[model samples]
Target: MGRIKKKGEAGNAKNFITRTKAVKKLQISLPDFRKLCIWKGIFPREPRSRKRVSKSATSSTTFYYTKDIQYLLHEPLLRKFREQKVLEKKISRALGRGDVTDASRLERNAAQPEKTGKPRYTLDHVIRERYPTFVDALRDLDDCLSMLFLFANLPSTTTVPAKMIARCERLCFEFQHYIIVSRSLRKSFLSIKGIYYQANIQGEDVLWLVPYKFNQRVVGDIDFRIMGTFVEFYMTLLGFVNFRLYSSVGLRYPPKFDKAKDDEAAELGAFKLEGNNALAASSQAPAQVTGGADAETGPDPQTQAQVNKLIRQMREADVEGDEAEVEAGEEETAVDAIDKFEPVAPGGDVLPQPSYSGEETESLFANFTFYLSRETPRQPLEFILRAFGCKRIGWDAVLGGGAYTTDERDPSITHQIVDRPVIQAASQKEDGGDEGETSQQLASNQRMPGRIYVQPQWIWDSINDGELKRPDLYAPGAQLPPHLSPFVQNTQGAYDPTMPLEQQQPEGEGLEDSDEELGEGEEADDSLAVKRIEGAAEGMDLARSDDEEGGDGDNGSFGGFSDDDNAAGEDDADESEDEALAAELQYQRELEAELTGKPVKRDTASPQSKAKVEARKRLAKQAKEEAEELERAKGMLSKKKRKLFEQMQYSNNKKSAEDQKLRAKRRKLEKQKTRAKA
Candidate 1:
């Protein structure tokens, strides 16, 4: 109406482009376009007005930002994709003509991209473009590590190639080695889906999951191609992260790996670290590892010395400059400036300081040499132990090599992790007639003297708690404490297994808080009834005397007051007085139990118990009143809001009820234990 409106002139029609048009513009296959979009951090987007965006828009059609598609037009990877497509065509044409040699030659050129006219392409530029800084990349590493680790654990299939799985595993192992060397591991928790490991790298907390080593079933329901694409991207990202991590610690990237040992299942052991300054300065390496793999011991000692000298020179220059300043302005130099820290937001945390001392925290298992029993999961336990500064790790002989000692009876081993239930002493049978099977069983089951034998959970718990728990509690056959998830933080009013029930429990909701009060509340009501009877008789006499006084005063003043009305009022007052007197007598009995210590009352119930009962009654009444009030308020609310509030109430009530049951269970256990002690 304003003017003959032009088609696709402005708005979403100009901004959005459908997937088909974008693919056509890119001059690549649909799958290739998708891969490029994924690599280049572009995705199919929705236009505000699909009809206006494109006249042919349908429910099946997907849309993308016109700008994102235009940006991808300049991607260098497009050239490689097109070249590969052309190479595939040449191979297919040669094969169609029955020219096997020509097809094979084309494949060779494809393998060796450098031999071709075009340049080789890599995802490095894309990675850098997506994550501008190292910290940004590290922030995104959670998903990368998770995907890679998942693929590493999965079985190889047609869709999931063996080579890809191997690459994922190697990258994971390299990352673990870096963690061990850097001592950056902070916490680990055993979860149902997998084991979660968290590390602090350059002030960023990176957490990743590793699934349990169970036989993973590759069901057809899963689209392995899509997952494999993600795996491909993650593998490259993790490789880069590992390289940076290795070089950061002054160690060589792609540390010399022994494929033979890897085939033998020596995962972390197969790699030999080549270039750390300390390793070069000290020629001592781990025992007997020299013959296993060929790797540089470390960088040249002279180079390290020169670097150290340069750092020292720079520090000296800074010191000399400070000294000159002090001499020039001696008056102000006497006083050094102190920096003040302020919260960025009002009432927020002030100057958040890093509380952890890395060296001290990492040395949890450094002094202890541990041996893992065959039944325990040696792989995860070993990795965790080594990561937290346990260098001298050993396990069963069946578990692949690189252990300091495979012998269970090795005297150097201080801790033995066992998961198997305690087998009754086979040494008894050995002493008798059975020596063959019994001796073998005895050898396997016998505890080494002075060595702490604990369940596998002990290691995880100790690492999470940052202190060694009492080993005796986790001894074989002992009821180990519940392994709570370290990731699940304890919130207010939630049940915490580590804390005593009385501490986290709501006020007066605690169990066995007043042992004497519990006894008092259970008193014989017959004695209380007799006291009430006596108090009622006394109250009746007092009530009558007061009534006579009131009646005489009223008759003198009014001179014609009716006796029936006076009698009715007097009778009602006497009944209320009797009830009050009975309650007072009960209170006195309880108070007597507290002070004079009446054996019957003390054994039965006490003043505190009576008060607790009253408190509970008051709390119940208050809760009921609040609930009624809430119902009234709900009637005023709209249907949707009322329904949401009801759901919230249901959930809160469910949680509170569960907490009550736990507290009650603990209380019952405490009572049973007390009775047993008695």
Candidate 2:
């Protein structure tokens, strides 16, 4: 009997809405609806069947979730869009008569509060609701951090406002300051997707991506209004996160930034944490305790008297002018000690001496400067370097607006960052005069067809040299910054078991259908049958037939063919035995063959001896299989056993029929191809 239907089983399937229906339900143009959905992060759903909901289902065509449509009606953005359209109409009408002031007045009036109106909704609640706790916010930080960093490095366009870019830059700087002071950075890698950085926070490994210096595109589909709303929310969230991070490390949040040093770094395209003004690093000297706090302190009388004697001797020696010599020798000795062994505790864990450090900054930053585009910001890049704990950064004045030291001869200056290839070419130009002609020539040289090239090799070199300090400098983990990974597909977005050969043979295209069908049949069988056997037997028959046609006596006889058949059967059995061995053994053998390493060998024997050996092997294999089948039968439920048995029989019959049909098809196709060629 058919099973009884459960409650809600038939009618409880999930109902989804189509794009057309959704657009109609919202009473907006399809394009506008699509825009709303994308901005809101709403995703489309797949229907179980076209009969239930599809474009053909109705005259207007398409279906939608009645509930989802009802929820969308409450969207404030949609209402705002509608209101803006009305305001735009009024403004346009006023402007049509050349009433510019009147149009402005009308626009202002429309923006003001009415007597009775709906309260404006902001993204404040969405931010809090999405990220309830600090850690929850941290988890979402990958997306937040990447987006912000990308925007910070982007050029100001109509789609992306300069103000928004500046805000993003400031927030990024604030976040970086927290990273620098806390020194929570662990590791970073340069990736094509972006620079990836990982840090440990509260025993959790937090990874984030940071984009390259400047490589963001303001695409049309991305709704800046929704993004701006999110940015506002994240700005507040990051403010709190930064505060918490600083306070935890016993450092003041928003520590006094030295405007002079900031200006200097900005000029030089580097920011150094001020060591004297505000909360200076020097102020954090280790505490020294005097003798009387814990117990009654008394100096040993003999020791004190001996110290006084040494002091008096030293005073007399100083009178002799030997103190200066002693001081110089001590300084040398201290320098030697520093050279011999200097230990550091990175992240509060004992580590060997750093491979890169401040002492190497001169060499590190030597010729170290970036030439920014006319559109690139000098402050943001400088701030970024400082945030990553690099106090010595330099950029070309073409970018820093002559606010920086442009002296290439300056020994202290290290790294140089440049975006324009023309800057590099012009600076390296042989002739200094005819600047206009030189620039035009350089501009022409810079143009490359079919590519908007941003050289990341400079970033990579700096990162590898350990000059770029941001934890996420090298795009690592999920924190890969934007455009860090290059555009390339490692694999075609499809599955093919036989595809691995494409790598081996570059000239090879796709496998033919006949070959694929054969492969599929073989793989489906899940048996250790040798494909070479059929071909080998045919070859043996042809050899014998040729010998017979030549009238070769014993060699042409069918008697020896009996032994050949037996030998081939024995080899097939041995191959089947190898197939059932451990998968690792098979893999290792293949690997060894590829490497031209030593291959494992089996003792060779005559076909009759091999047959005897394989016969025993087959018996053992059958015994193991029978025992496993018995165990499985005992454990399985009766209903499951019946179902499994039926499934096996159905599969076997289906496979037999498919094999026959495939053979027929293969013959027909071969015949057709031959005819076409003829």
Candidate 3:
């Protein structure tokens, strides 16, 4: 026979451990345990049966897998945490004994370990252990980049230090340098909250948003400590990723950073890169060594993975010689090759391709030089131009010093992006003021000769359309066209303002165009209907009182008295409608006789007019055709899918109605303008 198992010794009890127990097992404080879990990529676990795992389990109780807790025992960061705890105790003891100087000294030494000859811990191993491959890191870099960029723009608060903000900004610039060099940027969008960007790096698509350059308001709701923890980890991760990317292209990592240019907010211009010969003995060198340079070079993704492998080897070699911090058994870290997630091609025949002799859209702006007005956003314009193969871009002197030319009259400029309004030489404002002329024109804004002046939106619209848009439409002070979002895909049957009206309008609305156009006034011709509604309301009140009073059905006269009062009410309504129709017909006949200057003869027995009969029949035919089409479509869908399709039809019809209303308003305004001119 086998030995009997004890309670809380096997199965669920053995597998699951509570948060308190995990913290105890790791021999660290709760905060330290949280940090460790975050760095090691460990999360809370839920057991199938809480009662089986722990007899006292409750909804608030947090649990973790026993194996994960056990694995945390070998983490090198645990030693640093324990060391910090001891240092804290030493500082507290000194303060309690009134040795304030000693306590302050301990704190300063711990804070500045380099100056004090004390070794500080870096999360190098944790970064490698968490993400074994560079692509793995890149896949998760979306959140990292967004958070870092946001904090980089935020003001320094008591919660978030200035140094942290500076470092975040520096890292973000470094990452953008890599993006520019690689030319991996695929798309950009201008959104109200921020600008969004999508890039394809190493066949993996990454999308992230950057806040507009407005003063960031750090609200009270955010927990800076938690975000700071994440920022710390991401900083290390991105550094390593940058190193791998730079090494892949045989370019030096950390390139050259110019403090003077950075101080002046020269941004992307502050960093310069060189070939591999610029490398020092190790990768831990400072960023200030290299000088400033332009972003004219980048790395190839084909060799990124290979470079990561080499870096991993170097990391492993460096860790192997460390002074007895981690145990021999714990030193075994098997960082496997990248786990690829390639998209499978659909099984279908290949289609023919269209060839063109025109320049590719990637180089559409390559031949032209652009000069931006002072009012235009220099950074976004510069980035877009550089990404799309435009080499020489100039801006105002106040903006920065890195432009190709600060002079607006630069002869080489082919395009000038201006956001200012038109100036009429001040004549319209001064001389024509007494004549009620609106001073809507600028006084002195002249355009340079041989340069096409367009609004800032022209650049974005041209890039999105994959061709240069007509310059006349986007000219300054030319009632610029609506700047549509590039990210919103145009769907079939949806109302898009950019598309022709006749193409996407609903069938029913298009048919009613004649009636809509012929309508003379906005007021409704409902005089008879209003009288009938008043009469109906008087009868409805009397009926409601009768029902409340429990009166017998004695009011209906002339063989109409019955127990059912609803049928009598319906008959009364029919009689009232027929009387209203008779009154309308009599009025129409009188009007016709007055217009023709002849007596109007009544023909009660005559059939409906031929036009009316044909119109009714034609409407019936159209409705029948529509019903048949709907049936055919419905036959191909399941009941649930049919309901969803009907919902989409309702939404599309509503949107089409709105678009038609807008179009009608515009037509009315245009007619008013024409009448005023006449």
Candidate 4:
């Protein structure tokens, strides 16, 4: 028998701790403990078997990992909490003694850490510990960015201070500036709930949602305190992430923020990005020096000599007809030049150099100028478009200022993004009836020739696809395709709606054979029908020609015969022709039956055949009536309403097709997984 185990020493009892116990062990209040856990990435844990962990049967107990609680013991912020508790005790004791001056002094001393030579506690170390690498931090950035952006847009309330809101807004703007400068923003979508933005940072796609400006309604259902705590943690996390991202591209972190400009709502333009000259010089100096010396010193002597030698060798090799040797010599000379160049500054830090290939850094939208309609969200659209390299962006005057050109009829505008429904009314003529009127007088739906008009989603689709989509697909009043999530990865055996059915199938091996068989069967049936019809026609033609020949012979042989004899002769000939035709058709049917392996049957008309045919006609007539009724119902709707209904039907059909494709893909994956397991 095994030795008896002590109480609370068996199973998960030793591995898990209750929240109450954890708070007491940390010597902090519940709120403080919660804040610390959030900052340090510690979360509540559930035991596999509650009975094994707890002696009593209580369902309301919240458990955490024992090791996580133990790890929290070493956190630097824990000491700060203890120091605050001590200070509070000191102030309370002074107040109890009626020493107001001592109490005030104690409070001032506790608040001013600078005078005490003790710096404020920071989450920098925790940030490093939580995210071991920059990519890890980026992977977790979606939640951080989403939380911060949400708080930034929230109205300041009693629970949420104005200062916190301002800080969140500032941090968000600074982050947006980096994205704009780097052109990492990929896609954005305007939804009924809020605006969704996706950016590719360090190859990790980060998507966050920002609410529409001045549209967030604070509700009582949400606990602002909890949200505020989360916002606090994310604020620190995003700051570190921004620093790493900026420094990676040779730009200074914490870009200069202008309070005045920010207060004026300048957005991204308010911040100034400073370059890290030391880093840039270190990375580019080698390439510059290798190509040639600085303009002040001219080309280096040794490099010039090598270049001349390479040229001479190339000429000599060309004369000798050895092109390979000449190419090899040129490559060798280029490599030698690169190798000989050294860094000018000794003992300098060798930072990771950033790749600056022009092709890799090509702008997503380099050629087109866009105009935004009044109904569209101008601010988000402008920022996203400009970030992607659309320089000339115009908008309606009603959307406010800072536009490249407010004139909607600017002939140079290549693409216009309008969210409003298409207007069917023609342009109204003025009293003068002049052809050359101002652009504003033109009808709302009148499209400019040679320019493409699209919905707002066209820009997002183009950016996400990394190329221009067909303009007609996203044109105003056209039924738009289902917008799929970019985050979803297409796995093997997944059916993509964008791909054709033939490609989705497995090489069409069996399907091709079946289709060929069907085609051959159809062709055989058609050939048989055509041969039978031609045979019937030929038999009739032969009978007619024989009758005419016989009549001519009779007329010559018996010229004096009466008309009755002639009629009798014609009847007999007709009977003989009928018999011959019947025999020929019977023989043909027999032959066909032999070849097809089927029994031949006599052709006899049945009484029920007519009734069956009539029933089929009645059903077809009913179907036609129902279709006509639907058509009449549709005709009752106005033109605009009819168009909208058609659009709705088309959208529904598209959605159904997309859903079917996704279901097929899911089933295929499940089947494959099952087979693999088996």
Give residue 183's lDDT in candidate 1 (0 to 100). Answer: 75
What C-alpha lDDT do the candidate models reach, one value each?
A: 0.76, 0.51, 0.72, 0.72
lDDT of 4: 0.72
Q: List, residue by residue over 1-678, the lDDT tens digit for candidate 2.
A: 999975323431336666665776677766567655544546565455655443355454444555666777887667766776678888999899899999989766675423223333445444565567878777767667777876777788876677767667767766665555544555455676666766556566677777766556667887776666556556656666777765555445554544564454343223222222233323332111111222245668999999999999999978888767777997877765533243355424333453434434323333334333343345545534443445444344444332344433334544434343343343344566556511122342343233222333444345334454443343211222333232222233222222342343212122223233333443422221222333343344422334334544333235556657745754575565354343434465468666886664222334433343355455655676577565556566587777797788688768656644544454466557676788
TM-score, model 2 to reference: 0.41
Query: 234-268, model 4: which lDDT tens digit per residue?
Result: 88889898888777766677777776765545566
lDDT string for model 1 (1-678, tens) is: 478768897888888888888889999998888788777778878766778888888888898888899898889889988998999999999999999999998898785522443435678888878888888889999999989999999998878877778888989998988887777888898888999999989789999999999999989999877777777778778878888877676666788899888877888899987765554334332321232223435657999999999999999899879977767786665454444677778746557344425566688998999988777898899888987888898877678777778766778989988888777865444445544521123355677679898999999899888889899899989877889887775656778787887687776675234443233324546335544555466455655555455445523223456767755665587567556766666677688777887752432445655565556445655786578567668889999999999899999999999988888777777777787788
Ten-residue stretch with the least lDDT total in model 1 = 284-293
TM-score of each: 0.69, 0.41, 0.68, 0.57
Whole-structure CA lDDT of model 1 = 0.76
Q: Give lDDT for model 2.
A: 0.51
Q: 1-678, model 3: which lDDT tens digit per residue?
A: 999999999999999999998888888999888888888899999899999999999999999999999999988889989999999999999999999999999998685532453346799999888888888998998988888888888999888877778878888877776665556666777889777777777778888888877887888998888888898898888888788877755567787888888776677777776655544334332232242243234556869889999999999988977756455445444333334444357633334334343247657788999987767888778877776778788877667767778766668989988888887664434655543232222233766667898998888888877788999999888866767777676654455766655565544443333333233322122233333444554454433333534544444222455536655565475456545655665687689899999987453321223233234435755786589568777988999999999999898879867777866665566567676788
Residue pairs of candidate 1 with colliding backbone atoms? 519-604, 520-605, 520-606, 521-605
> Which candidate model has the greater lDDT, 1 or 2?
1
Candidate 2: minimum summed lDDT over ten consecutive residues — where? 285-294
Q: Pick the candidate with the highest TM-score.
A: 1
Candidate 2's displacement at residue 253, Å, is: 6.4
**If both were scored by TM-score, which would come out higher, candidate 1 or candidate 4?**
1
